[model samples]
Target: MQDQTFPWLTTLIVVPLVGAAVLWALPSALRRFARPVAVAFSLVVLALAAVATSTFDVSTAGTHQLREQTEWIPAIGASYALGVDGVGLALVLLSVVLVPLVLLAAWREHPDAPATGRAAVLGGDRIRHYMALVLVLEACMVAIFAARDVFLFYVVFEAMLIPVYFMVGAFGGLRRRYAAVKFLLFSLAGGLVMLAGVIALYLNGPGGPQGFLVENLIGTQMSTTTERLIFLAFFLAFAIKAPMWPVHTWLPDTAEQAPAGTSVLLVGVLDKVGTFGMLTLCLPLFPEASRWAAPVIIVLALISIIYGALLAIGQTDLMRLIAYTSVSHFGFIVLGIFAFTSVSIQGASFYMVNHGLSTGALFLLAGFLVARRGSQRIADFGGLQKVVPVLAGTFLVAGLSALSLPGLSTFVSEFLVLVGTFGANRPAAVVAALGVVLAALYVLLTYQRVFTGPVRDGLATTPDLSLREKVVVAPLLGLMLALGFYPAPALDLLREPAEQAMELVGVQDVEPAYTSTSTIDDGSDQ
Candidate 1:
């Protein structure tokens, strides 16, 4: 047997830490340099990920790649072991992709904040601090995806709270402090609960060569009670992050309160932490309990779909409306995962990346509109297409993508999810598809209200997107088009790792029938 020792996983963690340290150490006079430095660091990591991914031998995906294992604490049976399969690698790439784009979304723009009682989309006065926080937040998000150790995962998980908290509290909209507090309380409480679960997993694992590594957590013998408790503890934490129904009150407020750049990352990548945890930790660690809890979770997912849609329809603020739609989208992602069909799981994974890109773009475009028009009320943005044709067109593409228009990336992944879910659970899939219909309504409704009608008075005839904003959105739009047109390459990269994840979770040999992804080439290029 060949023993290949790669420090790639550690680099993923270390690169971000290096970026954060530089951002902190550099004086405010050099703050202008942070965005590019952060982007450069992120791109380097993405490149490293690509190399790791390129050399991956898919036929043997059941094995870990670029692994780095070392003992951290002798007493707790824990070690600093890290590695990636398909899921972690894909999310890590997605996180890297979004971080630079988010900084670009705010480039050349200041955070001129709105007052306490107003309805503003993206507003704040502290541009430097907001940008710095965003970079730091990206580092934390990347850590979450790259972390393979259970303890490291928990630390990074809670560490994410601080940057986003400041982003919301200091530079957000009218109720920034309130939203920040709400976000912190909900997150802190959940993290504490999950910490207990992580400790329990460490304590309960079978002694052997395999310990504290997610890949080694299979076939453990735990009582039904312990499994249930562990599952619930972790579930609650992820749920808040997932912002799933009932526990999701914090999301809309945070989205509404945070600046646009912050909201983009919040919805785009941070919220994914919850679903990722569900897929990575909850299902694999407590397989039987996940099965036990599936029915209950599915029910919550269904409710979130309906509730998110209804709330989105009722929202007047543009950013808040976008936030609510995320709730609905998250329900679909959750539903697919718990459904446990092979195709559904693949679709779930694909959905995470696709939704992140499409939704992140929409939030960015919406921010541009909000800043120019000085209001997020749908009534405030009429005939925008007349003054800013380019901006209107950009928003339209993102909006269409959000509604899963055929040939767009979202359509491909969401179709797979609905079909796969239908195969696994027909009734749930039926109702979930309704969420798709509501998606169209919400997306188009927002578009019509914001872009059609006569140009309202008092609105600035803002120019089209600046070079920086275009530089950011252009890649996103191109990416959406490219993926919508052809997804085989990405899917091929993902296949082996996802397959391996299934095996470790004891669901080996469960490949989704729809997993072939022939539809990516079926023709639809608008």
Candidate 2:
């Protein structure tokens, strides 16, 4: 339990939301200050998140901490409840860490720069609106991560699509509208399906305040048919959000068209809700159904790994290529979760953070390239390292992390995932391992094509990373290194949730077999 003296979790959600409102309501005369104000608010939330993390009792991390609740509507068995286990805290931290950076990176997303050839100028209110939406999106992200009530989670889950939809549609590139509509349609379809499951869970549950609380729903009684039906409802939604293979079409489009900051939040943090849902809701809520669905899910996960990697390798559009890489990375996350081992689950959880940083940097750096070159096509520029060694170097490091380079943040999580998968399903693990090769091929190939050849006809004047841009990307790159060399802090935070999740699914690691072979000389036993 958290100290009653302060509602830290609620504050984390409210601060950004309040800032959004203030920014939105500011008079036009004073509106020029909106961006800085929004950034300041995000920094405050980051500070609060840091404080909350520092005070967390890792010894009790397996269970929810910093719990805060208030009755929203007792009649429907819904309440405004929030809490964080190690997994949720880790994700919340990811959100906070990324939001301020995103704001800084996107400081000019609204007003199109001449070189980028992005959307035309907007009214004076555009920056205000954009910054407000970003803050709102951040608030929803925090709420979803912390919500302990299934009903509340669903509300925030569906609500999240709103700000992102606008961000894509209003502030993106040429095809922003199409991409935004596609993203919204897919997400809404999934949300509606998941809502059905939430309703069913409520109807079949023990009536009263405890009904929607996750703590009360686990191990609850339901007919096998009911359980499976509800599981499918939830799984379909999460799978779509996870944007697992078949349902992943919306992502590349959105990534290509949306502003880079929007893409960062969408792929880096928002998409994580899908895998997070599966871990926090699906398995625990329907243990039997999860195990029953494991084989099929694992197969799909494998397909996502291979299929996404292949597509990424083939892509000409840089943003779309990065999008496909996330599809592949997400496959690993889902594979780790459904593998039902402590190591795998923890790896998946840790991967969420690592993926956000690694992939986020990739997108940001790629966006920088696009902004400078005014083209996303791979063939448009070459020999970039000679002109912008710092930017190219940062991109290379980020790319290596994506490929799970040793001593990088992603390597720790990826290794754990593969090892855990091997323990559970050798064949699946083997197939998924192929993704590493594909990852290397795509990343290296992209690097070679874009940075190795002769400089394009007129790109010599392209500048290296500016002070602000470097500042924006430095922490993300630095953390990847910091975490890579020393993941003990993160692993310690993740262990408890992994154990708890394993307990829910009744899974334990399979011990390795050691055969004792004795050489019997003349039938003598030694």
Candidate 3:
């Protein structure tokens, strides 16, 4: 790990936090400036992230860089540790990039309006609260990905629930309260379990001023039973955060009820924490346990892939449909991580970034559609292409990307995942491949139902995307296209970390069965 004199990670975490506080503390007279102020803050954080990315040493990205450490809780040996490997950097970049876009998209969200009864009793400036929550969430998201201490990671991981809870409950749709409470309950349960694991891990480590630092914890000895138990503790938290099967029910409801921009962050950057934890913390800290658990995790991943797609196919709510697709996409990510090949791990890391772009675009565009129509139901509108060609076209592209259409960024990552998984476990890969087919069904069928029939009664007069909306979507699509054709930049950042993960997990890529022969010289030799 390369320690830095300058604390880049702290600045990245603090700027948004300050921004959120500024929005919250803004006087009523200046409340009108909340949106621009929030946007400005997010942009600043984005600039800092760009500089950090430029300074990152890609060659040694397998090791942490720009690390900063100082003692925090001496009693328990915890410290304020922060760092990023290639995988962590990729996720950090994803978090910062998405926040600005989400802010811009949500500019007019939560407008002030007269309320009755309970809403009146709870009333304040809704837009201000919403923007503040987003910035706060952004800060937490960055901190979680950059955290190098297990205790710090856990704190930020659970702290994130605060902003998200309000974003959904206070500013979301009809079922906002229900969705937010459910999300909180599920996440808190997972966190409590992981908390037990974190305490157990520190006790198992060499006690010091910084005992909870991930670097310090790596390779500490433990019995099979102890390690496996700890691994399951961490795994359960990540799986629920991952929203993997059995624990995934919160996602669709939350997505359906939350504001569109909030959903983008929730599924796009936030959910990645689970998979990120699995790769960076789980496998490295407990290799034997990861290997021991691989078979069951792989099976669950396959089920997530197939089951999520099948459910997505039957969804009537646009937001809920997008949420289910994420469940299916995350399955591919998990499969890649546990497949234990360098290629597969790299693919999983790449998928995390690409999934954010594709799904973020889908959610934002769906939000635009809902804003125009004032409804989230797919059956509420039809024949929109002619009336809103630009919106229709963009939605199609985003949907196609979700389905892993060739020449799209998602296809490259998903292709790598399947190919790599095939080398390790062919049957699992084969079953997961069925998700690709099901993805096409859900995406195209949704498109057909929402955009392709004769002009629906009210949609013919619908306006095309406004300039602000277009600006919101253009960057995400551009990046998707750029990465789709040329993934080397992302792959370069991901490769070393992936290889390092394989090393830490004590595994190697499966060898190819066929080899080319270069010496066929019967007649030529004669």
Best by lDDT: 3
RMSD of each: 6.2, 2.5, 3.4
**Residue-level error in angstroms, candidate 1, position 276:** 1.1
lDDT (Cα, tens digit) per residue for candidate 3, span 181-271: 9999999999999999999999999888889999889998999999999999999999999979979999999998888889999999999
In order, candidate lDDTs are: 0.78, 0.90, 0.91
- For model 1 the TM-score comes to 0.90
Model 2 clashing-pair count: 0
Q: Judging by TM-score against the true structure, name the best candidate.
A: 2
Better of 1 and 2 by TM-score: 2
19-43 per-residue lDDT for model 1 (tens digits): 7677677786786676677677667
lDDT of 3 at 280: 96
Clashes per model (N, Cα, C within 3 A): 5, 0, 0
Query: How many clashes would you count in candidate 1?
Result: 5
> What residue pairs clash in candidate 3, if any at all?
none
Q: What range of 10 consecutive residues in model 1 has the weakest lDDT sum?
A: 116-125
Rank by TM-score (best first):
2, 3, 1
